[model samples]
Target chain A: MTSETTPKSLRTIPREKAFYFFTSIGNYTGLSASSLKDFLEKINQVNIKSLEFHLNRGDFEKWLNEVLEDKKLAEQLGRLQRSNLSGDILRSQLYEIVSRHYKELTTRAAFSM
Target chain B: MKLKNNTIALDATDYKILEALREDARQTYTDIGEQLGIAHSTVYDRIKRMEQYGIIKQYTTIVDAEKAGAKKITAIMTIYTEPKESEKVAEKLCKAPEILEVYTSLSEELQIIAKITAENQESLHTFIANSIAPLPGVLRIRTSILTKKFKENAFSIVSDPKKITFIKETRNIERRETV
Candidate 1:
């Protein structure tokens, strides 16, 4: 979900706490996202290599859980981790989870207002 | 690690880290990463996943019981039980703290093999006579005291950690339809 539905304390993180993408060990793609919205965009732009690297290392879930304080996304990704999905299948599923969450948050924000 | 057909695939890095840790568990993440040429954070992450899967079961220090003045005697017990009661007997043995390990051999006759730990000879005999003999379907019993020491190799003992490629094992549970 986006920050709109997320608690203010966990809505958006500072630069130092942002999620960083890596192509592999010691291989940074120079891509980082400081918010869920930014993350959704960056996920599309970033290489599958970077996604695989971060997914294998569970970096995405760690960022979601530790920085964004979003357990829902973290848990959704955790289940995906077990699903043995990869490549575009993985990327699309990854995008779908976040996009669905982003939409969910946006809708909640709209209704709450 | 790569994903192939919805499974999380493990790479050499995970094994190398395990090999390093198996050689020495106290090695810091930084040390392993430096030797393996991966990011230290990656090393940490891999090990944590291994732990979650129970792949890395435990890190323990082997203690010399005799040198430490502990009256520990190891006994190898072979129990011949009725075929129908073999598993039951083995499971019962597992409940005893004194029973270190329980194994079943499917021979012509079902045999329960157990590694038993005891304080002294008298207790060992007492346990076998009292607890073991009284168990149902026990046809006979055999015991051998390990009188000497030998190699106990913790390393080099077991699987190749998924033939050098690890995969998280998941089982599908389905309900059977019964009339």
Candidate 2:
């Protein structure tokens, strides 16, 4: 099978199990993503406040580890969180890490299928 | 009194004062005190202390560079520098007017990310080839020219000070002997 058409088990979660973005404890940012690819995209448009909020709350790591089952990416993000980065720097760096991981994971999943 | 690390402790009142300043810096101390239910003199004293300690660096307007008739090409220049020379490269880059923002990202080694602005594509190319590449410890650079910006600095985000860790101010502190 082509990498794009690789088996479902080799892929990230579907739309049903998407992670949501939030600005505060109960304030949702009206954004959600199912797969790593989708999360990678939505993160850019989401407010830095949401990114700061989620990073501090361990929400992204939790969702990545639990819903996406990608502990490596989660841990990588965890390291960034501890670095005391905030604002657009956080967004850009977070994007760089997530995109790199997404590429590696997708390639690995394709081969493992 | 300054702490051992050249840092200052930010209490709830400090956070509230910061929040008020963030909302409208031009507002009078009396106005802030009225809103926060503190005396204007208290607000004045707190603000003065904050400024002296180097927390409130400067009160400046956040200009929309693009809208201000700046026909400059912006590039997200990500450069990987030798671990030991990271601080030197970053300090030099910080002094460059074209390089607006400089940040160190978490990677295998520290990576320098700079938001740069140039007059045109030719200038942008020249800048990378001439200015960036010659940096002694620079390993490689990846420049992503931003075609459009959906968002820039979101100043409206009122950060919670409780979660925010206060740290050392880079400015030289006038250390006074605490009695």
Candidate 3:
């Protein structure tokens, strides 16, 4: 099914759950050293209510593409469209995926250096 | 009065002094001392120590902006910034006359949260567009207009004795419920 046809339940991003996901990504990404620190910082600063509204309305991926101009990241986030997962579980899964991507990037950077 | 190196440890007497001063910063040390039954010199000493410890930043008047013919439209703006530019951006925003407070948020999507004030919505829009948007490293800004203000720095250092009693009674009720 198209992303547009995705159920509302799949799109829900709760505040505390979102907060956990964002903060985990921020910490793992190492804000002081990572190149995407600003991008992550921006994500961290968005009000919880605003983030919830955007995610609930399914504008999150669009916002990432348009504002952040990170289509790959947006597309990666788009993978979190499973209808069966509960909100908390979905958030945890999203956090794991993003954290893994950053972890790999961190390892690559360490190896390159 | 004994000083705790740099940071002064406040006691009941210190809290009473703070409460008195908060009520009226203009109140004389003598008046505060009289009210609290302490020596004026002791009150002065406590205040001086508190200031040194940065507990008391500055003494300033709280103005009724609307009554003073300066109506303000306040909005909370969430800002995204480039890596390590959040501090610089926050500092720049703070320097602007229209911005009231800039706070760093722990969220991943936002870098800073700034409270801005303008005479009207048009001015607020213009300031955000012209001044804030142009700041280097500022990636995005989302504003939410404040509708009502219930409290502004309303917490008291000195707790009301009645409230403390009420809290104790409530705790007993909560304990009973848990039991």
Model 3 lDDT at residue B61 = 95
Superposed model 3: Cα runs more than 4 Å off: A1-113, B160-179
The TM-score measured for candidate 3 stands at 0.52
DockQ of model 2 vs. true complex: 0.01
Model 2 pairs in collision: none
Over the stretch A1-113, how does candidate 3's per-residue lDDT look in tens digits? 43355322223332212222112101111111112333244344434443343354344465456443546656776656433343455555545655665566456555555
Scored against the true structure, residue A30 in model 1 reaches a CA lDDT of 49
List residue ranges in candidate 1 displaced over 4 A: A1-113, B2-9, B155-179
Q: In candidate 1, how many Å is residue B58 off?
A: 2.5
lDDT of 1 by residue, B118-165 (tens): 888668865765577556666667778888887866756223656443
Q: C-alpha displacement of A51 in model 3, angstroms?
A: 22
In model 3 chain A, which range of ten residues has the least summed lDDT? A24-33
Q: Report the lDDT tens digits of candidate 2 across residue range A14-113.
A: 4446665656433344466767778889889998998998898777898778776778888998999999899999999999999988777668766766
Could you tell me every candidate's TM-score relative to the true structure?
0.50, 0.51, 0.52
lDDT of 2 by residue, B1-179 (tens): 23557778776677788888987889999999998899999999999999998888889897777789888888887778889998999999999898989999978867889989899976875566556665667766667788977865435433454444332221223233332
Model 3 docking tier (incorrect/acceptable/medium/high): incorrect
Tens digit of per-residue lDDT, candidate 1, span A52-97: 7778767788878878888998899888888878799899999999
Q: Which is better, 1 or 3, measured by DockQ?
A: 3
